[model samples]
Target: MSQDSLDDAYANATYIPGAAEYPPRWTKEARAFRDNLRENDQIIEDFPYGEGAREVFDLMMPETPAMGLAVFVHGGYWLRFDKSVWSHLAAGLLARGWAVAMPSYDLCPSVRIRDITRQITLAVTEAAAHVAGPILLAGHSAGGHLVARMACENVLPTNIANRLKHVMPISPLSDLRPLMQTAMNDDFNMDEAAAMAESPIFKKPLSVPVTVWVGEDERPAFLDQAMWLAEAWECGHVVEQGKHHFDVIDGLTDPDSLLTQMLIGGDIA
Candidate 1:
C-alpha cells in the first residue's frame, strides 16, 4: 500500500464522527472526577516515579483497602496526552476495590518510544512499592502497545513480572513497522530496527496471561494489529461489536463491564 493509504489505515479520527469532541469531553469528565476524589481524600496527586516533570503519576485509592494495584496508561499516539487527562478511567478498577495508578510519560520528539516504555516500567515499579498483591495492567491504543510490551520477556523485572495477574491491551499497535510508514513516524524517529525491536508481536510473551481487545468498528489497521498480537502471543482476543476506537475504552469506567472484568479477573490462564 502507498504511504497515503497507510496513513488512512492508521488514521482514527478521520473516520470516527465527532472525534474532535471526545478529548474535551474526556478532559471535563476527568477533571470533575479527580476533584471529587481529591475532596474525599481518595487520591494521591502527582506521585513522582521519576525526576522528569511528566514522569509523575496519580494513585487513586479505593473506598476500602485496595485489593491490589492496577496501572493504566493513556494513549495519544505517544505524542499527546498526560496522566491527568485520564484520571477518570481509574473509576472501574477502583470501584472493583483496586488501587489505580495513572502515569504520564515523556512523549516522542522529547523521548523515544523505548524511553517511554522504560518510563512506564519505572512508574509501575514505583506504584507497586505502595500497593500489594497482584498487579494488573491495562492501556488504550498507544498505551495498549506499552502495556503489551510489559508482557514481553525481560521487559519487566522478575519481582514485578511474578506478581502480574493479567495484561489487557486495547486496540494495540502490536506490529509497529506499518506505523513507520505513516506521517506520524516523523516524530517517532523509528527506523526499521527500532520498530522491530519495540514491536510486541516480534517479541516473545512472558509466562503471564494476556488479552488483546479491539473494537469491531475500529479502523482496519487497529483490528489487524490486535489480531497480530493475539495470534503472535497465542492469547485471548475480543472484538466488541458496535464499538469504535474512541468509545471502546468507555468500558473501563464501569466496574461491571466485560473489559473491567477481564482486566482484574485474571481468569485467562
Candidate 2:
C-alpha cells in the first residue's frame, strides 16, 4: 500500500468520535485521582527510575497490603502522553489490593523506541524493588509494545523476568515493520533492521504468560496487529466487543472488569 494509505490505516484519533475530548477528560480524571491519593499519603509522585528528565514514575499504594505490583505504560505512538495522564487507571488493581506504578519514558524524535524500552526496563526494576510478589504489566498502544518487549527473553534481568505473572498488551503495535511505512517513521527513525530488532512479534517471548487484547471496533490494521502477536507467541487473545482504540482501556478502572481480572488473576465470576 502507499504511504498515505498506511498512515491512514494507523491513524486512531481521526476515526474515533469525539477523539479530541478524551485526552482532556483523561487529564482531569487523572489529576483528581492523584490529588486524592496524595491527600491520603497513598501516592508517591515523580520517583526517578533513571537519570533522564522523563524517567520518573508514580506509585499508588493500596489501602491494605499490596498483593503485587502492576505497572502501566501509556501510549501516544511512543511520542506523547506521560505517567500523569494514566494515574487514574490504577484504580481497579488498587481496589483489588495491588500497587500500581505508572512510568513515563522519553518519546520518539527525542529518543528511539528501543531507548524507551530500556527506560521501561529500569522503571520496572525500580518499581519491583518497592513492591513484593508477582508483577503484572498492562500498557496501551505503544506502551503495549513496550510491555510486550519485556516478555521477550533477555530484555529484562532474570530476577525481574522471573517475577512476571502476566503481561496484557492492550491494542499493541507488536510488529514494527508496518509502522515504518507510516509517516510516523520519520520521527521513529526506524530502519528495517531496527524495526525487526524491536518488534515483539519477531522476538521469542520468555516463559511468562501473555494475553493480547484489542478493541473489536478498532481499525483493521490494529485488529491484525493484535492477532499477529497472539499467533506468533501462541498466547490468549481478547477482542473486546464494542470498544474502540480510545476507550478499550476503560476496563482497567473497574476491578471486576474482565481485562483487570485477566491481568491481576482473580475469580472471574
Best by lDDT: 2
In TM-score terms, candidate 1 sits at 0.98
lDDT of 2 by residue, 1-269 (tens): 89999999999999999999999999999999999999999999999998988999999999999999999999999989998898889999999999999999999898999999999999999999999999999999999999999999998999999999999999999999998999999999999999999999999999999999999999999999999999999999999999999999999999999989999877796
TM-score winner: 2
Lowest-sum lDDT 10-residue window in model 2: 260-269
- Give lDDT per model, in order: 0.93, 0.95
Candidate 2 local Cα displacement, residue 225, angstroms: 0.6
139-220: candidate 1 lDDT, tens digit per residue: 9999999999998999888999999999999999898899899899999999999999999999989998898999999999
Q: What is the TM-score of each candidate against the true structure?
A: 0.98, 0.99
The alpha-carbon lDDT assigned to residue 175 of candidate 2 equals 91
